[model samples]
Target chain A: MNAEDRADHFIGRLDAAAAAVEQKLDALLAPSTLKGEIERPARLLEAIRYATLGGGKRLRPFLVIESAALFGLSGEGPLRAGCALEMVHCYSLVHDDLPAMDDDDLRRGRPTAHKAFDEATAILAGDALLTYAFDVLADPATHPDAAVRANLVLALARAAGLGGMVGGQALDLAAESAQKPLNQQEILTLQAMKTGALLRFAVDAGAILGAADQRQAATLTRYGAALGAAFQVADDILDAEGDAAALGKRAGKDAERGKATLVGLLGLEAAKARRDALVEEAIAALEETGLGDATATLAEAARFVALRNS
Target chain B: MNAEDRADHFIGRLDAAAAAVEQKLDALLAPSTLKGEIERPARLLEAIRYATLGGGKRLRPFLVIESAALFGLSGEGPLRAGCALEMVHCYSLVHDDLPAMDDDDLRRGRPTAHKAFDEATAILAGDALLTYAFDVLADPATHPDAAVRANLVLALARAAGLGGMVGGQALDLAAESAQKPLNQQEILTLQAMKTGALLRFAVDAGAILGAADQRQAATLTRYGAALGAAFQVADDILDAEGDAAALGKRAGKDAERGKATLVGLLGLEAAKARRDALVEEAIAALEETGLGDATATLAEAARFVALRNS
Candidate 1:
């Protein structure tokens, strides 16, 4: 198939997968017992729902499913993994927007959680969602194998916790200390931990779900790592070039804040070239696994990451 | 054996268990690969370590091990579970003391996390510790069963998240707006979710590690629920009457804020009576299980909760 036709087909599948994940999330979050008159905490629930449902490219979840598919496991387990990753992602964004953090007022074209509600509620909401993500994975109905579920939990915690996301955040804060100008390597390291780590987790988690052999899992890990870097590079490009309305967030804010970005460090053209190269490397890694049928859509998805408008 | 002698023996065992859990935590948080050249985020790590090692009664971790003993599963699994529960407890305490949360200046005779560091670092430290708790459980070496690990993750998440601790905090916040004093039911509900839920999870998670029958597990659950409530009641009593220096925190602060407490609603004498009754109930539940040897220390621990000064 031609690239455009292939891209269209991949997008359709991605949409279907995302819809399924949303449904599963609702079921997972629903109260188990309704026997008594349990008053729902409406505001907290609203914050969680708002943060989660706010529009963003469901790239992390998509990578999870696609990676699992490459390993010949396409079913409920992979879907649950996707949902869990998205929940963590949503939680991070909520906290990132808090007054004590990035303090952004807008996210995904809507007021941030703290802006919508109050700061305290937003903080609690993020904590609630983060805790709930693990609860979903632990649910008896979702993950049946104790060992695999534990692995997923551990993988997620490491990725999202201080050694991963929080660690990257701390570095980001330190790097932005008044007048410091971060080098390309430092910026790459920061982004790799901040964004790339979880994205890598999403793909690696899928391979774990498939219970792929060691060699096969390693290939998918490389694919995920490369794809994650590509995804961040593309994000940097969009922030520099895209319109705020189209991106659903304040564009060029990164540049204005003097935050480290691929575009800022590599220049726009070099950043674009790097994104392309990373996508190509990602597809090559997927090809090495020899699961051509399952990975065809994944290859196209990688290309779309480089080519998409927002 | 007399209560004092039994209590002493139990305390010693609990201390040993906590030390073991702390060692495991250190190992888990240590740098995984030297090639990464990533120094631990020292300040954040210091905050996490300080919060965790401040040395309260270690009640939650003790309950985890004691419950596992009831099912005859005494090994590294139970120890790991104990550590996981402690991590969650410590994380909650850190967040609870944030400027936007409780705004407390002291915890366990030391400065609260936010007071010791900056607000943002403390917040991230709590988040990191919480996520790390699940990581400990999901570690392949500790919990080989994916399904059981998932269940543990769910239990911890539900107990600690919005539906549990954070939810309780919201209720407490909203209760401030209510004109009428909170009733016994409302106070109990808040206490159950805020404190009892996690204590119960600690006990129940330990049970899940063993090969207990449904009947036996149910018996342990009943014991844990009653014990959890009794423990909270003691906390209420201490908050009402204990010395600040002895308790390692400000005493009577609950009453000063006009916050709802079992002691405030029931009066001091009645609260003490209820605590005794709950401890008796906890012991009775243990008796019903007919598993005395492994559960003896747990029963004694319940009574100790009622009588301890802080």
Candidate 2:
């Protein structure tokens, strides 16, 4: 298929995979009422559902399924892994929007979880969703391989915890009061940890579930890491130059907060060039994996990240 | 042996188990230096260590190891499970002391995590610990059975997340505004979800690891549930009547916040009586488990929960 046609095909598959995951997520999150002694509290569940089920690109879940498909593993494990990645992403977003953090009232063109619910509820919801991610992986009905499931759980935890997303957040917090602006390397490191870790995890989870050989897994990890960096660079550009309506979040807010960004460290043009180089590197890394369809779709997706205004 | 002698023996075993688990936790949480690109953020790890170690009674870990002993399953899995439970417990304590929540300054006779670190750092530390709990359980190095490990993960997640501890916190938040005092049943239900869920999970995890029969698991679960309630009742009494120095936290703080406690709802005498009854029930349930030594130690430990000052 032509590049455009291929992109369309993958997007369709991504959408379908995301829909299936949404259904599973809903069922997984439904409160158990088997024992009537304890009534399941609806408010916390409601808050979690509101935060997670709200509209977004579902990019992490898409990456999981796409990467799995590349590895020829389209089984229940990969799908559940996809859903777990999305849950982690959603949890991060919810907490990031809390009054104590980014404090954004709007996300994905709707009220943020903390704004829609109270701050306390939002915090609990994020905690619930995060814990629920592990629960999804642990469910015997879904992920059968305990070793693989445990690996996925570990990957998610490391990516989302102190050494990954939380570390990025800490750096961001520290940078807020810095006398000098963060350099390019610092910004890149922060973004890699903050945003790139989970993205890499999404791809790695798929490869692990697909039982890819160590070499194949390494290639895919490299591909994911590069793609994640490219995606973050694109995000920095979008935050600086894109319209708020298109982004579905407040544009230029990063600059307003003096948060470190690739676009701030490098000029917008340099950032764009860097994004292109990273995307090219990502595609080249994928070539080693010998997965023609995933390589093509992932390459197109990388290009799309560079070009997209939002 | 007399009850006192039996209690001493049980405490010794529990302390040894906790010490072993503590060493493992220290090793697991130690900072690893990433070469070249990624710098390990020492502060975040420091906060995590501060929050996790040198605090609390290690009661949850005691439950895990004690229950594991019931099924004659020893070694890494049980020790790891013990560490995981302690992580969850520590995370809860860290978050519970936040200014937006319990607003306490002291925990285990030390400044709360938020007080020792910044509020945001404390929040992230709790988040990190909670996520790390799943990581420990899911670690392939420790757990041989993926399915069983998954079960443990699910149990911990449900107990620590919204359906359990977080749910209980929400109820406590709402109860703060309630004009009427909570009844005995309400208090028990709240405590069950808040405190009992993890306690039950600890016992159940041991049963799962030991490959206990369904009957034994159920009996152990019952024992844990009653023990959890008794433990909470004892906490209430300590909050009401114990010395701050003895309790290792501010005494009577629960009453000061106008939060309902077993001691507040029932008078001190009635609360003490209920604690005794619950402890007796816990011991009776353990008698049904048919594991002689572990059950005996557990039964004595149940009584110690009511008798110990800290």
How many clashing pairs per prediction, in order?
13, 1
Q: What tens-digit string does per-residue lDDT give for candidate 1 at A1-310?
A: 8867887788898788878877777666555531123454667777778788736768788888888877677788888888889999998888888877788998888999889888777888888888888876776544566667777887888889887888888777766663778888877877888888898898888877878888888888888778888888999999999888888888899999888888998899999999999999999998898777778877887787777777
Report the lDDT tens digits of candidate 2 across residue range A130-186.
Answer: 887887777765556667777787788878877788788877877887798888888
TM-score per candidate, chains pooled: 0.94, 0.95
Model 1 / residue B195 / CA error / Å:
0.2
CA RMSD for every model?
2.3, 2.2
Residues B1-310 of candidate 2 have per-residue lDDT tens digits of: 9867888888897788778877878887877622225775667778999988765567787788888888778888888888998998888888778877778898888889889888777877888888888878887755677777777888898788776888888878778877987887888888998888888898998898888999999999999999889989998998888898988887888899899798888799999999999999998898887776657878877988877797
What lDDT score is found at residue A282 in candidate 1? 94
Per-residue error for B49 in candidate 2, Å, reads: 1.1
lDDT of 2 at B201: 90
Q: Give Cα distance to truth, residue A12, candidate 2, Å.
A: 3.3
DockQ of each: 0.56, 0.59
